[model samples]
Target: MSEEDYRIGLIHATVNSVQPILDAFQVHAPQVTLVNFMDESLIFELNETGTVTKNMARRLLNLVEKAVMSGVDGVLLTCSSFTPVVSEISHLFDVPMLSADVSMLEKAVDMGTRIGVIATVEAAGPTTTALLEKIASKRQKDVTFKTVIIPDAFKALQNGDRTKHDKLIHQKVQELANDCDVILFAQFSMARALETLDMTTTPPILTSPEISVKSIVAKISKKEIVI
Candidate 1:
């Protein structure tokens, strides 16, 4: 299929994540069409419960099912907190399905033994760390993780305080620079924080949207739906 013919579905848990991935695609693969499915309630419920409930998983599956039924070539789940659920339900779909952070985490694992994960959501930090460990274990590599959760930053972003949100993440990135081999921002929304940091001065800090977009684009280009 031609690049324009490929349709990738982006499943988001919050409005915060939508734009970053869209920006990434605009920069990296503008020819591919994107279809978005968002459920803001998922994030609210997750924040309240502090975990993924069975109902949440079912909702996520239904969303992906709807995306597939719409004829997307692949599905990208944009929330790190719900990433683990992708592993459980991906086999049910023929198209490739991916959690946004998986590509980033795999790259982090390959780059260093000590990985630092920063997130603005309570659940995202642990979810990212667990996924990192899983990636390392699958590769038979021993890895250590340091996770920092700044719920306040998430609140700040939600309230339209982008300056404060970026500042908080920038501070953590600086703190983790010397301590870790690499730093990873756990949410697609946090990608904006990179603009405020001096990349040359920090450890290889990574974000999900760009890497995930490139991964999905490559897969779709090759017509390979391996997840």
Candidate 2:
């Protein structure tokens, strides 16, 4: 690949919380280009209605494929709960496609036997719990995963109510602090909430950015050739 060919496509639910992750990536791989395709409001809707419309999925796929066609070295999906569709897309592209939460999952598995999944979006809770369970079972260790949702935070973010969103997330995470060994932010957007909450009273809080940044950097250093 040419020096100018390093590019990545980020498919995100919202652009708000993704800035730090991208900034970290920029420092590690300055040559890499980022193509951001954001819905900005879908996560909130999914939280409110408990559904992701087919049309929304279609729109996301279209933009994702566009990024692939635009010559991205790899794709990093930023929405944790949407990995079902991301898995299909990765198969279709037959390239490097990393899930947003793979890093956090790996860390949680290595850290302790009990994991807590905290997602501000209601629809994400059950789905994220299953992911943690699957990862734990693969390691031949029976682990327990507890999921808790912050009521209405997603909706509040959608409505531009940052204070309400932050408060609810802080409260819910604190409530779940006593139950698990490690806290995994199930949604990429929840990173901020994790920071807002008091970490002194809880287990270690893990975010996708730390893991994804490392994962992407490794991929870059290995310099895998796709074509």
Candidate 3:
């Protein structure tokens, strides 16, 4: 039951998120083998319509089923916009299934009442804000979540202008950090820039990839589960 033998599946909305997830695993769980499933079009499709269709939810479940069939020990979903889909399907599989932003979202709410969720896509904002609201309601906590969507940064990253993308995110993070009690980067892709970010100006910024990876690793290791 060595970590090297464990296989974890990562499903991404776009290719941009994979590198950051991989980079995070390299630090936190280097031995866990990764099987990545990327559907870059999913993010674009969701953003265009600003809602998750029935077919889209089915596709998300299908992808997770596909990953389980591939012999993964656990699955970590790296798309924030698919938050609702994840909730429907997580319990469908015996293996641990984690929604990308839940841990960060919970932690943000725990930190304070005023939460700033920064997303580079429109679709991500609604789903994540809704999630935080649900959690807040469950805990009977009065919380206000403000979402800031910056699709320009997302476009820059898609076009290979990472410097522009990171700069754009950093500027927004600084601004959000000043306004809110805690900042949660809403997309998995945004986690890539976390390391290089100068955090002097931001409040405690939380990203999903690292926390998700760590949670998945804990699940697989604790259960020594296999598909």
Question: What TM-score goes with each of the models?
Answer: 0.96, 0.85, 0.93
- Please identify model 2 stretches exceeding 4 Å from their true place: 1-5, 26-31, 40-45, 48-56, 220-227
Model 3 residue 10 distance off true place after TM-score fit, in angstroms = 0.8
Per-residue lDDT tens digits of candidate 3, residues 8-61?
Answer: 999987888888889889989998899988777788888788898887787788
Q: What is the C-alpha local distance difference test score of each model?
A: 0.92, 0.74, 0.86
Looking at model 3, the pairs that clash are none
- Could you say which candidate leads in lDDT? 1
Tens digit of per-residue lDDT, candidate 1, span 1-227: 76778899999999999999999999998988999998999999999999999999999999999999999999999999999998899999988888888899999999999999999999999899988988899999999999999999999999999999999998898888899999999999999888878888788889999999999877776655333
Which rank order by lDDT, best down to worst?
Answer: 1, 3, 2
Q: Give the TM-score of candidate 2.
A: 0.85
TM-score of 3: 0.93
Report RMSD (Å) for each prediction in the order shown: 1.7, 2.7, 2.0
- RMSD to the native, candidate 3? 2.0
